[model samples]
Structures are given as structure tokens and as C-alpha cells.
Target: MKRKHTYKLILFSAFLAVVGCGNQEKKEVAQAPPPSIPIIQLTTKTVTGFKEYPTNIEGVINSDVRAKTAGYIQKVLVDEGQKVKKGQVLFKLETQALSEDAGAAKARVNVAQVEVDKLVPLVEKNIISSVQLETAKANLAQAKANYSSIAANIGYATIRSQVDGHVGRINFREGALISPNDATPLTTVSDIKQVYAFFSLNETEYLDFLEHAEGKSLEEKLSNYAEVNLILANGSLYSEKGQIQTSSGQINQNTGTVSFRAVFDNPNQLLTNGNSGKIQIPTVYENHIVIPQEATFEQQGNIMVFKLQEGNKITTAMIEVKAAIDHLYVVESGLQKGDKIVMSGVGKLRNDMAITPQEVPFEKAVKPIAKLFRN
Candidate 1:
């Protein structure tokens, strides 16, 4: 009988231990805290999108200073980067050979004139035929023409600036033989008071620009187009804005792009020929939903965000991004105004996860990119 009582006691003790362990597990489950996450409410705002394209700068007029007549360079009058005016002498070529030829021709002209004078007297005295006198006069005219031609060549030896601008590198120094048929020029001069920024757009982009651009005709559209900003190679904005001047009507066969030219006034002469930069064109979108780029994450090929649902449960929401400017995105679809999305700790949240929603002001979420939305 005593052994049966001890067995009953052991069974009761095991049942009590099991009940205590179950209660402990329930207490631990009650004490667990929900994941904390910062959330932002979406809103519609006016935003402007900017698109940048590579650009190359050129002077309004680029004139090549070349040799008109073949000769050796005697002296380089102007140095590189010198500001010169029209008709300023830039180079002097050796004219010794041309001068010698002119002297010989002048002597021949004198001889021919003497013959003509002698023949006229003979003809009047009936010592020579009138046709012979006429032939002597023709010879004198021919000799004078030869001398004039040689003198003109000698004049061509002096090279002058064709326009008022800055001079470029002088290719031929003193004693360098230059020729009219030579491939390279002696130097270059560029008129840079007003500069041209050249850029290209592909076929698709060109068509889009034409469609969105204001006006019925291409010329009218270009005239009505807004001014664009230029970013220099050193990553600074150009002070003056540029206007679109014109575009190539046809596409380039090799590049599949149409070229565009924009003009900018350079009163200080800061921009020069052969400069490179980027052109920023602005497009405005009204009443568009904008979001911080940090609030969204990429999943597979689609962009996603964790949206706060009823009962503090979070669900993955896919968003369609129309354009990305700076650290913000202009959303096209898949999100609506007043919808709340997790702003921080987006990586820690999973689908249907419960979270303690820490409501953050929408302005605070996108404060870093507020300036980018300016018109």
C-alpha cells in the first residue's frame, strides 16, 4: 500500500512541473516587443525633373590661319593665346625668292618697253612692218603682267589675322617651310565673345523633345524652349544660362543621333573652344507623388517599399518610379497620397511583419532632397 502512494505522489509532481513550464513560456511571449520602424506618409507635390547630357563647347567663329603661298616662315609675330585684331600680322614668310623673281621680271619689262619704243620709230620711218611694232607692244604688256604677278605672290608671304579673337598654337615657327597645299594650318583664331555648346540626342530622345517642346514648327519650338544650365568639367555651374539655337534636321548615319547647338554669352571669355561639360534640361511635373529614395528597396527587378497596414502589420508594396532626381523619386503609380511607408529599417522588415509604427513627418523624410523639387 505504501508503494502505491509514493507512485501517485510522483505522478502529481510531474504534472505540476509541466504546468509551471507552460506558464513560463506564455509570460515570455507576452513580454516580447514589436519591431520599431519609422514610417512616412506620401503626399502629392509639384516637382521638376532634370536630364543631363554631355556637351562640347566651341567658339562662334573658328578661323584657320593658313599659308596662301608656299614659303619658309621667317618670323612668328604673334604668340599663342595672344589677343589679336583683324588685319594684325601673325606671321612673316621668306620673300627673297619671290623678290628676286620680281626684280628679273622688272628688268625684262624694261627691255620689252625699249624694244616697243624702238619699233614704233622704225615703223613710222617705214623701216619695219606695222605688225612687227604691234608684236613688240604685246611683249611689253606681257612682261609687265609677269612682274605684277610675282609682286602679288610676294605680298601673300605675310599672314594676317582674319578675325578679332585669341590666337591658338603656332604650328610653323621661324624657318619652317609652309605651303598652301599643306594639311595643317599655321595657327587658329577663335572669336569667343559668344560661345556655342554642342550636344547630341538619340533618335528616340529627339522625337520626345520635339513632342514635348512648345510650338508647332521646329523653329518655333526652339525659340520657345526654356533656357538650359551648363555644368563645367570642374563640376561648377556656369553663371549664364544658354538657349537652344538649332538642331540637325537629319540624323547622323553612324551615330544615330541629331546634333544640337546652344548659344551662351561669354562676356568674360571664360568658356572657350574645345571645352567639355554637361547640359541640364528641366521638365516639370505637377501634382506628382514624390518619395525619398531611401524609403524604397529593389527586389528582383522591381522596386519595393514596406507599407504600414491596419493593425500595425507591414506589407511589401511595389512602386513604379517615373523619374529619379537626386535622392528622390517621382512615383508614377502603385502608390497613392496619404499612404504610409516605412522610411527607416526597410531591410529589417519582412512581408506581413508586425511593427510598432514610428510616424515620422513627411518633410523630415525628404528634407535632404527638398531643394531638388524646386521649379
Candidate 2:
């Protein structure tokens, strides 16, 4: 009877211990805290997507100054970067040899004229035949032509500016032998009152532009195109906007790109030939849903965002991104305007994970990119 009572007591104690462990496990599960995360309600707004292409800048007129005649440069009238007017002499070549040749030719011309005069009187008296007088006249004409040709060569010794613009580098200085056949020009002149920014788009991009751009003809489409912004080399936006000037109209077989040119007024002469930057062309999206890029993630080649359900449970919602600009994504579909999405901490959140709801303003979620939509 004593053994039976001890066995019963031991069984009772083991049963109580099992019951106590089960109750403790239940309490720990109940007290566990849900993850806290910020959420934002989506809104419909106008969003603009921008595509930037590298650009090469040039002045309205870039003229290369070259020597018209072969001679040694006697004087350089203007320095590089000097503002010059049309017909202004920029260089003077050594013409002493040309001058001597001209003198000799003139003497020949005078001697020919005297012979023609003497021959005309002799032919009138029949002292010489008419053919001899004709021959003398022809010699006079040839000598006179030689004199005019030498005079023209002397005139070419002065190099002048063909247009009113700023001078570029002086490749040849005083005493430098220059000729028309020289590979390099004496200088370059650029008219920077207006400048052109040349850029290119790939074949696919050009086709897309042509499809979405408004108007029936290419000219009309370009005319109706929106003004583009320029990002300078130093990462600053230009104050004035530029207009689409022209395009190559054909794709380059080698580069597979269609070239485009945009014109901008440069009253201050700030932009010059060889300047480089980027051309930002904006495509405006009206009444479209946009979201912060940070709020989304890529899964299995698809972009997704976490959305909060009724029980504060987050679920992965697949979103189609039409375009991404800066830090924002232009959402095409898969998200409604009133739906709430996780503002951040997306990487930490899992599908169907319960979270403590911390609502935040939509502007606060995407404040970094607020300026991109402004007109």
C-alpha cells in the first residue's frame, strides 16, 4: 500500500509539471510584439519622366580661318578669344616677293604696250603686215593678264575674318609658314549669340519618341515638342530652356543612333563650341500613380511593394513600373490610389507578416523627389 501511494504521487507531480510548461508557452506567444513599420496611402498625381542624353555644344556659326595663299605670316593682328568684325584683317603674310614679281610683270606690260603702239602705226603705213600688229596686241593682252594675276596674289596675303565672331586658337603665329594646304586652320571663329546642343538617341528610343510624340509630320512633332532642360557639366541646371532645332532624320549605320540638335539663346556667350553637358527631355504623365522607388523591391524579375491588409498584415503586391526617374517610379498598374503601402523597411518585411501600423504623410515618404514634378 505504501509503494502504491508513492507511485500515484509521482504520477500526479509529473502531470502538474506538464500542465505548467504548456501554460508558460502560451503566455510567451501572446506577449510577443508585432513589427512596427511606416505606411503611406497612395495618391494620384501628375508625374513627369525625364530621359537624359549626353550632348555636344557648338556655336551657331563655327568657321575655320585658313590661309588662302602660301606665305610666311608677317603679323598676327588679333589674339585668340578676341572679338572680331567681318572683313577685319586677322593676319598679314610676307608679300615682299610677290611685290617684286608684280613690279617685273608691270614693266613687261608697259614694254608690250609700247611695242603695240609702235606696231599699230607701222601697220597703218604698211611698214609691217596686219598679222604682225595682231601678234603684238596679243602679247600686250597676255602681259596685262600676267600683271593682274600677280596683283591678285598680293591681295590674298592679307587674311580677314569672314564673319563677326570671337576668334579661337591661333595655330600659326608671326613668322610661321602657312598655306592653303596646311592640315590645321590658322584659327577658328565662333558666333555664340545662339548655340546648338547636339545629342543622339538609339533606334528603339527614337522609334518610341516618334510614336508618342504629337503631330502628323516630323516638323510638326518637333515644333510641338516640349522645351528641354540642360544639365551643365558641373551638375547645374541652365536657367534658360532649349528648343529642338533639327534631327539627322536617318539612323547612323555605324553608331545606330539618330542625331538631334537643340538650340538655345546664349546672350551672355556662356556656351561655346566643344562645350559638353546632358539634355533632359521630359515626358509628362497626367493623373498617374507614382510611388517612391525605395518602397518597392524586385522579386523574380517583377517589381513588388508591400501593402498593409485589414489586420495590419503586409502582403507583397506586384506593380508595373512604366518608368523610373530619379527616386520615383511611375506606376502603371497593380496599385490603387487609396491603397496603403509600406513606406520603407520593405527588405525586413515578409509576406503576411503582422506589423504595428504607423501612418505617415505621403509627401513625407517622397519628399526628396518633390521638385521633379514642378513646372
Candidate 3:
């Protein structure tokens, strides 16, 4: 009887132990993590305003250096990729024919002067007829005119650079015959000390920027801003600032963009013609709301950002974006002062979800990464 009672007690105790183990397992499973969503606190602060426009790097002055007179090139004084100054002689032409023609013209001028002197004395003394004296005077004038023309032609035989610039691509060699209207350019000269940025903006962009632009001349509704910047091909920002100069009056019917130009002081001569890059411009003028790019989400052709409300619960809101002002999106509508905004972990977020919200510092929220992507 004692042995049977001990067996029954052991069985009862074993059943209680199993029930306790099952209860402990159930408690652990219930305590696992809920869907944690990243929450950002929104604050009303002054946002920086900006708008970027597509631009290209261009030469301040581009010229095709050509010869003025026809001749065989006697000597090429400069080579390709050489720097030249204004009025620098680039090449010498075979001037034997030109020089001889000039000498003959001078001799004719001397003979005409002698005839004029003899005729003047005869006319004064009434020894010669008036008609004969007039004829001699006319011949003297014609000879002088011919002499000047030939002298000018001789001067044009030497090729000189018209601008201060870097020379490019020599097309002719020594002893090569060149003409005034040859299809091949002998060389090219480009002044890159200050580069011109050629670009265009539509009428809508013009209207948005017109108010912020002040104290500058406006042509055809486009105005020059006091400052500009250049982005290089290797994704570098030019240190110098440029100013807008002018714009063409008519819009290009095919592209629907008006032509404009800006001049940037390129002291290092780093920018060259045909270089492609971007231009950032300040377009809107106002104290507006801005949110971090991470906080914003795109859904169904509309941009939505989550705002934290009472009890740390998130609520969905739609915002009207004016432009991406720097690293932040400048908000036009649908947000107010003192609204709590979520900054990071936006990809794992949804509407009406509860979160353990914490306020991050403003600098940490607005600070942008150095990586640049074309807008």
C-alpha cells in the first residue's frame, strides 16, 4: 500500500511540472517584439529655399581663327594647344608676290606726284589748256588710291590672333596653301578666364523667380541674379560665383525653352567649352515648412509623410511640395507649426501605428550626406 501511494504522488507531481513549463513558454511568446516603426519629431523651423536648373559650361568667347588673304604658309609660329595673346602673330605667309606688288604701287604714286606738280605750274601760267591740267590731276588722284589699296592687302597677308585665349587644333602645316574662305579652320581660340553658361528656363520658372530677383536688368521676363555656381563633369562644385548677363528674346519653338547666358569668373581656366553640369538657383522667397527626404513617401502619384500625434500614434498627411530646397523638401502646404514629423526608418512605416517616439536633435535630422545625385 505504501509503494502504491508513493507512485500516485509522483504521477501527480509530474503532471503539475508539465503544466508549469507550458505556461512559461506561453508567456515568452506573448512578450516578443511588436512591429516597431521609426518615428521622427516634426518641428516648425525656417527652411532654406532653392531650385536647381540644368546648365552647361561654355567658353566666354569662342572664335575660329582664319586667314584673311590667300597664300602659301611660309612658317607656323605656334602649334596646337598653345596660349596666345591679342594681336599675336600666329603664322607668316609667302609675301614675295605681295611685297613686289606693293613696291610697284609706290613707284606709280611717285610718278603721279611729278605729273601733278608739272601740271599745276602750267595751269597757273596759262601755258597749258584747262582740260589737259584737269586730266593730269585726275590721274594723280587715281594713282594715290591704288597705292593705298595694295599696301593694305600686303598687311593682311600675316595671320594674327584677334583674342587672348588658348589655341587649339592646327589644321595647316608649313608650305600649305590656304585661302580666305577655306572649309577647314587653321586653328581655334577660346577665352576661358571667365566662362559663359548657356541654358534656358520656361515661362513658369521665370514667374516663380521674378520676385526674388531684385536690382538687376530684365529682358523678356528673365532677370540676372547676382550670383551663380558651376558644377564640373567630375561632380565638383566650382568655387567661383557667376552673374547672369543676358537672354535671347524669342523662345525656341521646338524645345519650348528660352535661351539665357551667365558669366562665371574662372580664374584657374578649369571650365571649357561643351562641358556639361548643373546650376542651383534660389527660386522661391518665403519662410516655409521643410521635411527630411527620408520622412517623405510617395504613394499613388502623391507624396505623403507621417506625423506623430497623441499617445505616440502616427497619422498620415499629404503635403504640397514647392521645390527641393537643398537637402530638404520645401513644403508649400498640408503641414503646420509644431507638428511632430518622423525622419528616419520611413520605409517601414504605416498609418495609425503606435511607436516609442523620441525627439532627435535638429542638426541630426537636417544634415545631408555628401553623395550627390542628379535631380
Best by TM-score: 2
Report the CA-based lDDT of candidate 3 relative to the real structure: 0.78
TM-score, every prediction: 0.90, 0.91, 0.77
The TM-score between candidate 1 and the true structure equals 0.90
Q: How do the residues 1-375 of candidate 1 rate in per-residue lDDT, one tens digit apiece? A: 999999999999999999999999999998998977888998988877788999999899999999989999999999988899999999999999999999999999999999998898889999989999999899999999999999988988989999999998788899899999999999999999999999999999899999999999999999999899999999899999999999986899999999999999999999998899999988888899989898889999999998889999999989899998778899999899999998977877789998888898887887764456633
Comparison by lDDT, 2 against 3, better one? 2
Which residue pairs in candidate 2 collide? none
Q: lDDT tens digits, residues 233-275, model 3?
A: 6778879877778877466889877777888887887777777
**Residue ranges of candidate 3 with Cα displaced over 4 Å:** 1-36, 47-51, 54-64, 106-128, 183-191, 215-226, 273-276, 283-287, 325-327, 346-349, 370-375
Q: How accurate is candidate 2 locally (lDDT)?
A: 0.92
Preferred candidate (TM-score higher): 1 or 3: 1
How many angstroms is residue 283 displaced in model 2 relative to the true structure, after the best TM-score fit? 1.4
TM-score of 2: 0.91
Residue 127 miss distance in model 2 (angstroms): 2.7
RMSD of 1: 3.6
